[model samples]
Target: MEIITINYPLQGLEDKGPIRPKTLAIGHFDGVHKGHQSVIRRAVDVARAEGLEAAVMTFHPHPKEVLGRGSEYTTCLTPLEDKLERFRSLRVDIVYVVTFNLTFAAVSPAAFVDEMLRPLQVKRAVVGFDFSFGAKGAGRAETLRELAGSDMKVDIIEPLMMDGDKVSSTLVREALAGGRPETAEQLLGVPFSLRGTVVKGEGRGRTIGYPTANIQLAGAYVTPRLGVYAVMAELSDGERYSGVLNVGVKPTFHDSLPMPVMEVHLFDYEGDLYGSTVRISFISFLRSEKKFASVQELIEQIGADALKARSVLSAFK
Candidate 1:
């Protein structure tokens, strides 16, 4: 898949001469969750039936983050690289990562079409029903269609629901934050995962006979609820191991730290995984983090947690 980082004001495209007509799936696409997958799939279906290039346009830094809407908007469910990977998996031919800044946000609905979509020869655009654009987000999905007129067509997908609840990124976040990864998986159509590199930590786990791989998150991701969970780790070589993942400070030993530490003890695995990239998928919440009275007590509880994690993970297998 071709990934293009289109700068603001849409520069350097003149050299290509006439652009190819394409069908674009445009959105923030934070998680590429079930609802997002539907929109992108529809765009691909439309592109294939119409014999046009299947393309996607996603904004970076999120509009809310750039606009200073709220502090909660700072982190992301999926980073830019992760989002691109999902788009590629959806069989999108091209992905345009548009820079979302103060200047571009000021572009009116009509001007956005006249300046960007028209130039790119976007014949059709697929967006969600609640999609908005332009300064202060004054343009709705209907506004885009009207503004584009004869130059471009628009399709707006309605809200997807599960168990009478809307399937959305916000709901996904809430689920993960509340230690409900099963619900998140239902919304995402896959397990909620965190990717990171194995980093060195204080060799305390090894002394306790429960060696763990300390993880350093790859990017700014929304941290899952702080506690222990049943998780599976996929190494760089594609080996997967089910394990007990802890997402909190070692309350039993240290004082409250500024940031929580993420560490996992994979079952039936023993190797040097330092510097390796591991993707950990949250399977189930085991228990909340607590401060044990003694180190042996903590050790005994961890052994129990391991047994419970193994039992829960077996069903997933």
Candidate 2:
């Protein structure tokens, strides 16, 4: 599989030379939730049937994030790294990380097809039912079909529904924000997880006898409601460990800081993990964060959380 970054000026894309008219899947694909995956799968199947490369075209920095426009949302389901990994897992041949900016955003629909899609020799294009492109999302699937006509193939995948409601990134975000990990998982096709490198912390958890590995995260990632959760942590080497994680300030200790923190206490194992990248998959919510009356009470609560986590993960190994 080839992963290429295509810059502007259009003609330069040919440096790699003209490839086959690959089937292209286009979208913002913020989370690549179940619904988005439906579209991606169709594109891959079409590419396979036509015996052409399967390619995905996505933007960087998310258009809204770059434009400093729209509601400042928190977190993306699949960050850039995770998103690319997921695409590769689906056997995609190439992913063109289209740099999104004011200039690129202003390109007209016809110009986009001619310069971007046509140059890539896109024989077929697949997107969501409401997918749009070209300057403020002025182009729709219908418009793409109109512009390309029979010369280019186009398919618009309808929304995927689960249990009546449409599966979507927004719903997943809402679920996570509300501490509904189980619900979020239903829509994502897997448990919700966050990946980052372990970093040093204030030594609070350590002092309390439950040493923890802190993680630094990126993306507009949402913090699961202020509480403790049962999670499975995956190391870079693919090792997995069941752990208990707290996502909030130390309310029990009366800390007034609003900055949320993630502290994971790995069950039954301990070694130097600092600087090591890890992915923590949320399994279930344990309890809401609360203000304990004293350090003893806090310790007791943590002990209970450890017990709950143990029970939850007993069958995982």
Candidate 3:
């Protein structure tokens, strides 16, 4: 997929070249969960039927972060790079990453449709039922359709439900934050995962006979609750291993730490992983993090956690 970054005023977008008319699936698409997949798939199918290119439009830095809303309150499901990779996997033909700033945010609904959508040759637009656009979110799907007039078609996908709850990024975030990865997976149609580079640690896990790969997260992703979890770790070369992962401050070893760390002990694997990137997919929650009086007690509990993690991950295999 071709990724194009656009700022406000959208200069040279049309002058660069003329392309096929686009059927755009537009949304924040944070997690790109099952609900988002449905919307994108629909746009792809429509694009194929109408002989148009399938495109996805996403915003950057999140509007909330730029508009005086607290950045800490907004935890991203996937970073921009990961989100674009997801879009590529969905076979989108084009991706427009719009820079969200005060100037762009102030674009009127009519101007948005006339200047942006028209210049891009958009024949159809697909968005979720709750989607809103334009300054102050003054435009709705119906309003967009009206603005586009007879030249463009609008599609509003109804809410997708799973386990009696609407499948949404907010629900997925809540599940992960609450240490319910399995529930988040059900909503996402895939395991909730974290990608990070293996960094050097304090070597405490090795001293305890359970060597761990300390991970440095690449982006501002939502962190799961502090706990031990059953996980599957995939190395850079595509080899995957079942593991037990800890997300905590290592209270047993230190009084306090500035930040929580992610450490994963791969079952039956022995090799240097430092400096390599790995993806950890959370499967199930095992136990919450807690302080232990002695290192031996922590090791004993970790042994139990490993056994339970192996049992859970076996089902996945």
* TM-scores, one per candidate: 0.98, 0.95, 0.97
Cα lDDT, all candidates: 0.92, 0.86, 0.91
What is the alpha-carbon lDDT of model 2 when measured against the actual structure? 0.86
Candidate 2 lDDT score at position 195: 92
The ten-residue window of minimal lDDT in model 2 covers: 67-76
Count of backbone collisions within predicted model 3: 0
What's the candidate order when arranged by decreasing lDDT? 1, 3, 2
Model 3 quality (TM-score): 0.97
Q: How far does residue 253 in candidate 2 sit from its true spot (Å)? A: 2.9
Winner on lDDT between 1 and 2 is 1
| Candidates 1 and 2 compared by TM-score, better number | 1
The C-alpha RMSD in Å for every predicted model, in order, reads 1.1, 1.5, 1.3
Candidate 3 Cα outliers beyond 4 Å, as residue runs = 14-16, 70-73
Q: How many residue pairs clash in each candidate?
A: 0, 3, 0
Ranking by TM-score: 1, 3, 2
- Looking at model 3, residue 81 earns an lDDT score of 89
Write candidate 2's Cα lDDT for 1-317 as tens digits. 67777655465665776778789999878777888888888889988988988999998868887777756343567878888888887888889988887888888898898888987889999988888888888999889988887778899888898889888877988899899999998888888988988999888888889999988885557677989999999998899999999998877765686688888999977789999999999999999988898988899999999999999988788
Tens digit of per-residue lDDT, candidate 1, span 10-51: 999767455789999999999999999999999999999999
Candidate 3 accuracy as lDDT? 0.91
> Across residues 27-60, which tens digit of lDDT does each residue of candidate 3 receive?
8898899999999999999998878899999999
